[model samples]
Target: MIFRPIVPQELNAVLAQVRPDPSTAVSADTVRARLADGEYRHRWIWVAEPCPGRAPLAVAIWWGSPADAHPSNLDALFARSDPMWAFADLRRRTSSAPRPTTDPRSAVAAALLVAAHRVFAVDGLVPAPDYHLLLPSGWRDRPETAASVAWRRRAAEGAGLRLTAEQLRFERAADRPVPSLSNRLSFTPEPDDEIFVDLFRRCLSKSLDTTSTRKALRIGAEEHARDEIAFYRHGTRGRRSWWRIARTTAGQVVGFAIPSHNSVVPVVGYLGVLPEFRGRGFAAEILAEATRVLAAETRGGVIRAETNLSNHPVVAALELVGYRDRTRRLVFSAT
Candidate 1:
């Protein structure tokens, strides 16, 4: 098979070949919308074809901020040897499909990812972009869901994308009452971005965020903090003034909250409590304050946030503050 980026003229044919899967939520309309909005560029979309003149067997779509020089994440992946593969075909082959053997789709997808990563690296994008696969809540408990995810997981791992973090996605609708907050902590906007970086670095001491913690371990805390600050500053659509440092009424800095937005919707950008202030129930307070800030500004639109599934404290805080569990996101990255 030949792996390469798709041309603009081939987009319609390429999209027509893939089957829709709700788990990935990568429908043609959605792909078209993102492409139109600059989140998905032609160069970021790759495919594996039998030959130069044939139809693509698999397609990989990457997503990035409009301002980003390179794509940040793999949003959708679809592969099938048969161009007609769909729900009917999947249902017909469900019982006969061999579980132990590697799926042909997986093989093609792996080749596509490997080729795409090499090109991205040649262009100076080091450490391949992460691949995010969204699974339903309790997906592991469902046999069909588990089986479907297995092939994609194998494809990702085969392409050197190690399973890094599993996150619990949460969404709070505008109708959900804004969580109440106590007067124990006061939030004030800091004009300096450096102050937020220092606090972000301090919070890393006992952070449960798998991605950031791993980054700090690999590149040191100081640089990791600066990387994160720059990401939020330039990559996201959120305004800088939305950031606030949370402190006790006595002027003791407890934590910070960032009420931010993405290209799609508002999000609880980031929040962390100081190590010394842990176990004082400040996380919920800080998160609630961020939610309030976003709600007022967005005029009660939906706000989303995510936390590492292993981070029980943050998970509990999110639950307590009225954010409903939406889905589980499995992130794979090349280390």
Candidate 2:
């Protein structure tokens, strides 16, 4: 039978039954805090009804928009759990279920995830969501790791989610000197959203994330550019003072950079160089100036950045400015 959204009275009981992992069990206090603080709501929590009135065998809870949740929320809730997640609308989400080591119980969890997608759709969210797996550094070519990945891949396939792209996250401490701010490209502050989208079109490339997401959303280049700019209009977590467009001395657009932050840390929102201006090594200066602006604002905190694995040139530019690759993520979308 399908699950129902849990009510506040059942919050503790349902949370108690959710065992996401044997190693990282989420505490009731933590779940209560997140819920009471409004990180999630009754609708975002689902429970399987194996029968009419008996306790649920599995549960799925989603942390909705405001973009992110505390990273440890899931693992601690389930004690060594590796929850599958997605970006259904404006935020990242995951569902808690019994580990799929056994048959009927696993099926129940997968079904619940499918159901949650339908729930998210009511809010105009895309059917696809991202399942995040944070890998340890240097986790390549290991037989056991490969086996684990294969198992997850099969399970996701069964649920109609496809593995699309691999991403690399780069980070640096703010104390790192941003390569000297540019003298060639003038900085334009507070440009209209239309202007930013137009400039982004000049920088869009064949990115794995961009490609898969475009197909999933079935949007054209211009629409996707607008979405991209909207994701980083600056001031999501910090001030709008950090947004800038790089233009030539004559005020022609050359590139752009957005330095923003999430709930956790300062981030390089978007760094792009126009196609006609590529290979001139202009992105370094653009990014450096953005970083310099944010670093000053953040007072020497860590700065975060990410790019698709297939987008090598952008990756190279980030490295040139001293961004260290830290984590690798695989994005899965429900087909």
Candidate 1 residue-wise lDDT at 312: 90
Best by TM-score: 1
TM-scores of all predicted structures: 0.91, 0.75
Regions of model 2 farther than 4 Å from truth:
17-39, 49-56, 67-106, 140-151, 205-217
Give lDDT per model, in order: 0.83, 0.62
Per-residue lDDT for 1-335 in model 2, tens only? 54567877777677667543311234556567657756666766777654566666557555543443321111111111222221121012234432444324334556566676665666566654555554434546666555444544444554556645677888888897777644788777865778778777756653334643455356767887876676565326666667898888888788888888865688887877877788788877887877888888896468888888887777887898899998766555553
* Residue 166, candidate 2: alpha-carbon lDDT: 70
For each of the candidates, the C-alpha root-mean-square deviation to the true structure, in angstroms, is: 5.1, 7.1
- As a TM-score, model 1 comes out at 0.91
Model 1 residue pairs with clashes: none
Best by lDDT: 1
**What tens digits encode model 1's per-residue C-alpha lDDT throughout 18-117?**
5667457788888889899889999999987665777777899999988788999999898874533432343254342222334666656766787898
